[model samples]
Target: KINKGGQLSMKESGEKDKNECHGGDSRFMAMTLKRGRKKKALEYLLKKEESTVKAMVDLKKKYA
Candidate 1:
């Protein structure tokens, strides 16, 4: 799925009942910067950080 800017969604699903999402946040930022979209990249980075934090919290809860 593409977002509003025609960017590919980072969300994905796996065969083994696992949801596999790419770490495309940084890559997306890189691409945006290359295209001279610094502000957009920064916004994406913020959202990416939130997602990372949520993932970390989930992992900790599962393992701890």
Candidate 2:
């Protein structure tokens, strides 16, 4: 079954199996996904900053 987050969850046979659905696994998975996304964004920002600094240095050297 697809959950509201578009993640495929186990379609439990019991309607009262709410605990199984909202257990630690789903929470852990969400945290892991956030961590991966955060890491990627940080890497991208660092690379952009590095390129901007390099460009500034090159421009200063050209004008000097």
Off by more than 4 A, model 1: 1-23, 50-64
TM-score of 1: 0.37
> What tens-digit string does per-residue lDDT give for candidate 2 at 1-64?
5444343444456352442356422343344345655454334334334543344334334433
Error of 1 at 13 (Å): 7.9
C-alpha-based local distance difference test score of model 1:
0.45
Q: What's the lDDT for all of these models? A: 0.45, 0.41
Per-prediction backbone clash count = 0, 0
Q: Write the per-residue lDDT of candidate 1 for residues 1-64, one digit (tens) a residue.
A: 5443234444545232122233333334445566766576556555554655354334334433
Q: Flag clash pairs in model 2.
A: none
Candidate 2 residues lying further than 4 Å off, grouped into runs, are 1-48
Worst 10 residues of 1 by lDDT: 14-23
- lDDT, candidate 2, residue 53? 35
Give the Cα error of residue 57 in candidate 1, in Å.
22
